[model samples]
Target: MTETETAAQSSIWTDEPFDVHAEDPFDRGSFVATVVRRIQVATADDPSTVFGLVGPWGSGKTSILDRVRSGLGDGWQIADFTPWSSGDAASMSLEFVNTVADLLGEKAAGEHRAKLAGYAGFIAPLLGAIPIVGSGAQGTAEHLLDAIGSRPPWHKQFADLSQAIQTLGKRVLIVVDDVDRLGGSELLTLLRVVRLLGRFRGVHYLIAYDQDTVEDLLRSTGSVGRSAAFMEKIVQYPFETPPLPRAAVIRLLNGVLEELLAKTDSHLDHLGLQRATSLVDALAPQLRTPRALGRFREHLNAFADHVSTARLDLLDYVAITWLRLNAHGVWSQLDSWRHELRSGERATSLTETEKLTADIWEGRIAEAHPQADRTGTLDVLSFLFEGVDVRERRTFIKHPRAMNDPTYFERYLLLAIPEDDVDDELIRIVAAELDPDKFREAATALARVLDGNDDALANLAISRLTVFRENYTTPNLLLLQFLAERMHVRVDEAERVGSPRNGLRPLVAREMALAVLAGETSAPDIIEMFGETEALNAVWMAPRFAEFRDRRSDLAEGFARFWADRLRSEPGAYIKGGRLGGVAELVTFALEPEETNGLLDPAVTDYDSYIDLAEGFVYAAEWVGSSYTYELQFRKDAFRSLISASTLERYRPQVLEHSGKVEYDVEGHPSRDIPPEIVKAFTVDSLSAL
Candidate 1:
């Protein structure tokens, strides 16, 4: 496999506890060393002692115990007791007693082993009929039975085991981990074994558990006193695990995120890094332990694999994945609330209804997660989405790569872009290109993506360009020229393609070109640049630029007429498969009365050319209220600018031949071409002939 392929499969983080000093990011080793020294002093003074290592779940309790065990000298014998492995109280008592005996017997030599077995024999018959659960337990049970054939009274047996432990001259440390995992009766039984039955001279107990969990279990077991009082009686010297510093947790989190970025070949820019730091700060309260950080890392790994991380805003990706893992209930409703969230992104953009909805979601999110720190989660939500709290007005410049942007919002939530939507990476490639030819080529290629002859992607692309408009260069002017001619085709594509988030407008291309030129050059300079170009779009642009001198100046009129005359020079550009929108534009802004009449004239002999001309009178009516009463209508008002009423008399035979093919229902909905309304309107006009 290639190196790149191998790197993709490798993991950069793990949740396993650190076993060595160097791997201890929490400075736990020093604490462990102190614990070890304290145990040595406490055990030297008393033959048997119980020390409780206390913390909440995932707070590294086991790690501390492991370190303390390693810190002890060779003279110490360690026996790990896992009470959860046993099914009942009897099993737990029996297994624990045997564990101590086996530890002593295995290390003791010659007469010491015999003496250890003799001591174990005293307690063998007392623990009645509990099934042996391990090989060590079986061996210890047999050794105890063989060493002493007869059983003694309970007190005498307890005394014998205690004396034997004192005489062995070896220090024993019994480490019990995750004691809180045991059930009610089992937990009470294990505590009884430690404090009463199994307490022997020179044997020390280091019990690790979450104190809150242990106390809660003790209460459920019908303990007579307060849970803390019972725990205090059993655990003489209790040490609570220190709370993890918020700064340390964030530092560790940052290091892990940086490693993940490197592993995925993704990097954050200065702004991205700043946003990430702020998000981490906001998220620190929930990320209270190494285990929580590990969970975040796991989520990040899955996100990196599932989506194109390089194309997303790093801050948004990290924030979203973290929210999904930690605040699942709120995350579940994000897609449904996308519209409100998007409108809320800018305070000025929100309506009163949307503002009310945002307030409702804020309260709802906090109510849904009552156990969470309400203010902290709300703060994170505010940071994640600007619209979540319009009153705060946390304004920032919007970017198309942000998950909160309406255009890319679905891509973030779904982890894939829609077919008609252009990817941000593709936009970046065109934006970054410096060479004029290459940039225009890339932009042209983007323009070719259409949905059944409608320029869907081009509309979406131009809408997304607002975010990257500041990155435009002199070479980007070519894009302006390219879009100018095609803007008419892309006008209604956003609606047709069902991309409401595109937010397209009729003059978006013209406005975008003006924006691109705001700092680079003046309006007159654009005329100088494209003055000699043969491109029709350039000719269309020249008059718009000339308007800067005066809206109706002679210079602007000349430029408008020049565009119309140029169109007259090349009639096929309009007559052959061309959009009629161009001719409407010329009549509105570029043509004189005579020139409009001349340009509107087309070949009536050829069927294709005649149909193209006839289409100027055909129109598809939009829905009124809810229903479209007239599917197709032909109105003379649509042709008023292009042709005079007198001119219509010249095409009487052509209109009649096409009008004879008309078909429609009584309500005037056409099945196909040749609108019936055209024949009705034409006959009425002929009766009152000019």
Candidate 2:
């Protein structure tokens, strides 16, 4: 359906005060059938044990009790528990015994009830005026029982009555639900009451337990065995309470989503209805059975409670959960990245300084959670606010810095924008809908994420951000810092970008080689330099680090050089494997450029032999070249990549082919036909000696 057309239907799923137990003709049949059938078989012969309907918290257990009570009319007796929100199982036990007496006592032939009722009348009012004065309550019970039973002792009267009822063979059944709600001692006492009731052969007790809930009651009183014994004898074995039949669960869930959808004038068709029902039905078992459905649904209701005039289908509930989580996860990834940056990075030169790359998941990106997508709000993070790149050296990311911050009121402007609007103008407009502070804070927060997590996360964010930028360069300020701080190493301008450091041009040569290899756009002035746009894009989109890592070797060298210059300030890098014995190297390498204002300014007679040493490392690995060379393979790789294949075809020859054998054909692309082993060598040959 068209958005407008669908919105017009106005589903009731989004509505408030969802009728927790409104049985409908189409949906109630299955759930009610399961419940009724259980009750029928148990009580069919005579009054069997009250149908033990057991389940976990939020399983809509109370709703089932209400529905069964309503469905059966007067047939079944339900004496539910009301343990205080903080009440323990022990306290609830007294209520259990009293409830049993009240349900079964009145039907007893004789003055038993009148006596009990008289005691109840006086004691209840007194307790009403006072506290703990019920007929069977601990303090007032003994006092009132003697007065009402008219016996010297109250226990004698109760035991006599109990024995008389046992001899008569009258079977009485009472159901105690919400047992799982009580914790600690109160729960044990409730269970104790059931076992005590087991003393009378004709009396039966049905109790409910939440499968997912851990009963503090059993452990506290240390009477779980007693409760188990009662279950084994008085209660039936394997009291399996299956899930709420799918249709009924759907109906109840639909009731939950009612108000929000109702405002939009949405009525669910059969297809919509089926989809909505199945959304809950299928997911209820996965998150942890139907027992926790209410808690799960409660989260949905709380999130969507403010959403008015929205289409509240079953998926709507999932959407709200999904959106909240994605928004939070993006925030977390950004936060983690921010915490990992260098001290200086925080002051200026934000990490990524590029466009935002926050991931806005549109569906359940993790485990099976239908509610995660219920509200259709998953892509909310994809929106953007004001942004601009200032001073090629220092990037400033912010929500439009107006005197009063005009962007604060942008959402209202969006109403004027077309619904089909997907560009920055539209995004800026919708952003106005959100609180300006929220948008600004979230946006700024997203940018710092690039610098987040120091170098490690910077690399990952750079790679991911690169891919995102490729799709759309206009992405707002999000996760920029995460990509920036780690991936882009800021080289201090004080470092020499000139010719020859000592006899070693390896440093400047490599930098020159990288600058040359990247196009003219990559030329770093005596100021800040980020990674190549192409390289950054490749890093973001490529699935494997190898694919992105393949291009990053040159960029990494530049970054390393920049830092090497900075380290000269204290010159503090841990020394390893050298004649200097890991001494800090303060000297900066320089090389003459042959060209000016180019990717690299290379000059002539600047040949620096690859230092033949024990070893030189690249990233996480070391390369062992010919004649015990300590040269990094990246320099030659870049120079060769930039030079025409014919320039060094012999020395940097096509020694091997892509097929891994010898490439006898010198006519092919120089690197294309080279074998793996042949690909490693760097030739000293001159292509104009280039």
Candidate 3:
């Protein structure tokens, strides 16, 4: 769909506002209209009533304020000034009076404006507001206005101004907005001044402020405690505003999405606002309440391109919706389907059977994008598998990842996983595929299924590889050593093995850990890599070090000492530089270092990231009992996560298990000789991802 449409589709997911243009169909709709409704309600009378409007920092709070102030009803004085934006204390009282005078002129139309100017009297000079209206219009009006503005104890003129406003209306409601934005002294002045002004009895100072401001003041300046000492001195009623309710928020989501969708027909067209509304309602808790609906509004509009075109196919659209609907389903965990399949008395036999079928397809997806995970697959997979008659357990290879297609996972893993609603059909496809032999065949069958052109699986195939038993067995041992050395951890003594990263990224330092799983990088690499004093010192106080410190402080400290020594020798590490852009990126992906990005000079633009990619001239010195392949046998083999033949078959009879035939059970099930422990250990869900 077009860019405008994707918004309608995504709108159901969130309720936040977006940047719809002035001309968009939803711009003037009931959704936005409601936000302004409260403003109008308070401003509609001859004498406006006091009300508070609060929202997040960037949530268009000021826009509502501006609209209300401009459109307030006739014969009402509005004294609204945001002193916080200017960041000054002295000018605040003066600016407030100017606004009050302006409002008085607007409310009176033309009657008392000149009369008001004449009355600024002794209040003018003291408050410093008179010269602002007329340079030297020296009289009681000027003097009084300035006096009131500068706050020079002008009880008489202040009461006079309030009484004059009351003559125009029953009472003057001073709308002091955004007082929360001002710093220290300005805030105190506003509260104190407004409190003193309220002494006129009928007038009210309506204000809105973040609780954080007052809370911070209480924390830093003991305002809360100090104010308690003077509690009796202040006479007033305090009605703290309550937060918006849950159901009202859902209504807010509906109003916004329904209104926004009317623009391009994507939301209503693709998922129907009803279902969209349902999805949004369900997300309140996950979206973190308060402004959930508003954020939905924003996210919806952002992906407008995806939503509008979604209207073309009803099944595809609903299928997509169903996935999001069941986002927290089986695909949420690797053992979910197995856990259910293994369950009996309460199990949905037909349900389990159907879900099992979907899993067969999932295994292919896993094989295809070995790097991918099962999250997000239920949506598209549910749609694709929904109509696929699973009674006979027929197999078909649709886009993988059970809920999300392989294409989505490739992109998703590079970022964070979006919480998706999932569909049931995904589990069915996976169940049938999990029957080892069938799963293996179906996975291999995909090469023929797509005729090798499935666009979604194309990128995924880079990690999905076929292993020949003849070429695998004992030949690939060096890969194990290589992996072991790099990870700073040991690989088992067992010679050879294989794995893939097809669709999603590896989890838990998995980029580096996958090498360990595939026998390419060792755990020791992690240990020894950190053992470098120079490398350790380079990254000691960085924020990314937080997780590394928390998770494995022992390893991190070793690297810290190693780096300290390394840096001490050089004294100027990065200043004595070599390119590290790739190392920076790779390590970032691997270690997630928060503060490791030592900046480069603005002029040095062409940075290479391959600082450690140099092919094996080992950095260890002889003192560490490490010789240059003297006693050690060095193999001239290139390392890759996936298994290969030439590199393996030469060393051992076979480097990995590449045989087409593994012994099968009578029912054609692949032998569990592969070991459930091994299968279980091979997490379809990588922990590193979380």
Candidate 4:
């Protein structure tokens, strides 16, 4: 989209005033008309009356002033003097006189324009530096001096200007706006210009200001006594802008919110609307003016750009954005305590120190939002961070996209995925590719991709599949079989030794495959897929499938036949690579004692072959607790069940000679070898009796 289209879709307010009465959403048209009528009457009756339009800052004072100016009928001379634009007393006074003269000269006849310019030349040099207005100002001053025949006294010049002003057929009104924005000297200089220097027979002043801010500026001058009394002497008639109704502000906010939500095509359900309404109502005190609503729109618009708003809990997002903008201290606290605040069911009781810290945090939040209701704020916090201590009337629904989910809390705060974290896109792709006909091609394409750490992206993909397994349909064994084989590709044992992030892909893939099989009821379909898979994959998966075979008689019978055929065809492949360890259960299930001995006796004749066979029974111990706890352990029962007593006797002398005392330290020795326990299990563990 183009920039204009994006801006058109946004609900952010620019905070500009309405240009016409038809644009008044705050019911200020009648107010503007009334103020204009009073100014007209006051200027007509008293030639030099001072009318003051007063209100607090940002209370639509400028809008009302503009509307009144636009509503007035023509034929009156009006000059707008913004004293805040000038930096000092000299510049402010010079700019004010020039503004009035230039505006009046625009419509005056040639003779009357000359008189107005003469009056400006007479008064401006006395207030500030000469030749300051522009290069043409000097020539005009010299011509005015020649016309007067010489430089006159100050009082005499004032009298002459007063007489010349009465000749004009129009009443002159000088509108000085935002006077409260001036500094001490600049403000005093402006008041002097309005009440003393510029006050003529047919000139009137209409000034818009915040009464409180004007008084404060007057007092800051340190020369004025009783600032309010001083202002009364300057402004004869004072009126405050009309009060803005709360309902009107609420209506404006609702309109902006509707526009924003419409762009997203978001509609809140009944409960969602109720919750959002409650949150907005709780913030009513802060949204009492057009400027406040504009600021809120700006903040929310920026927030919506960073998060997944479609899946977001809309009410929760709104409340969070409000807290971030208005209650900054509380937002910082939320960020610091995010882990504890978004945790699931507690596993243990809180310590006394932890409870005290929580109480202190609550007190700090209350102090930050002192004007807000304690119950309302806490309820909002509780809803957004579910672990906070607040009860709900109904069960809380889980939305992973919401800020309350622990997995998503950092994503919301950081506004991007962390480096080690898995992207939701991978999970989405895995879920989409569950079709049996397309699984192999998609899985193969995905497995070749690498992550930032240069590891196979398939590891993270399979891990995500394990986490979201329930979301998938019944078994897609082809995908599972592919993952099983891809995961078993050898990783450097030294690289995986101390780092928990490495070398667990096969385990995750195995668990995911089991989870898929648990949902499958067709035994023959699973057996056929298993038979078609590579020998390494089939053997790697056999133990897990055997776990459920007691309830599946067809699997028990079919797997035995499949295992016997693979062994008869290529038994040496498993023996040479130490993969024979994983298929021990199949060997015992499929072959009789004599058949197993005949197939294995010749395969284990050498020391290297025996070690490889023994390596199958050994597993790297679970890396838990610490590095000292990681070592190789052998399953003696599985080894004894497969290797016959005669074969054990034949391998005993070589095992005793080659396998010395085993060192089980993983940190000191990162490499793995067949441990002495395997040798003992093979030669001296009552296996000969068997």
Q: Which candidate is the best by lDDT?
A: 1
**Segments in model 1 whose C-alpha atoms lie over 4 Å from true places:** 1-14, 105-148, 306-310, 342-362, 390-397, 418-422, 430-449, 452-462, 465-470, 476-690
lDDT of 4 by residue, 620-642 (tens): 55454544344555656556766
Name model 3 segments beyond 4 Å from true.
Answer: 1-75, 106-153, 167-170, 197-202, 224-281, 286-291, 304-408, 413-690
Instruction: Write down the RMSD of candidate 2 (Cα, Å).
Output: 19.5
* lDDT digits (tens) for residues 350-408 of candidate 1: 56243544456567677666555555556566666656663564533354377777667
| RMSD to truth, every model | 9.2, 19.5, 26.6, 8.3
Candidate 3 per-residue lDDT over residues 30-125, each given as its tens digit: 433453354444322223233554444433444444544444445345566666643222344445556556655565636544433433333333
Arrange candidates by TM-score, highest first: which order?
Answer: 1, 4, 2, 3
Identify the runs in model 4 with alpha carbons over 4 angstroms from their true place: 1-15, 26-43, 47-59, 73-77, 86-94, 98-173, 198-205, 210-216, 226-229, 232-284, 295-398, 401-423, 433-470, 474-561, 564-678, 682-690
> What are the TM-scores, per candidate, against the unseen true structure?
0.67, 0.37, 0.36, 0.64
Q: Output the better candidate (2/3) by lDDT.
A: 3
* lDDT score for residue 51 of model 4: 85
lDDT of 4: 0.58
Cα-based lDDT at residue 516, candidate 4: 39
* lDDT (C-alpha, whole model) for all candidates: 0.59, 0.35, 0.36, 0.58
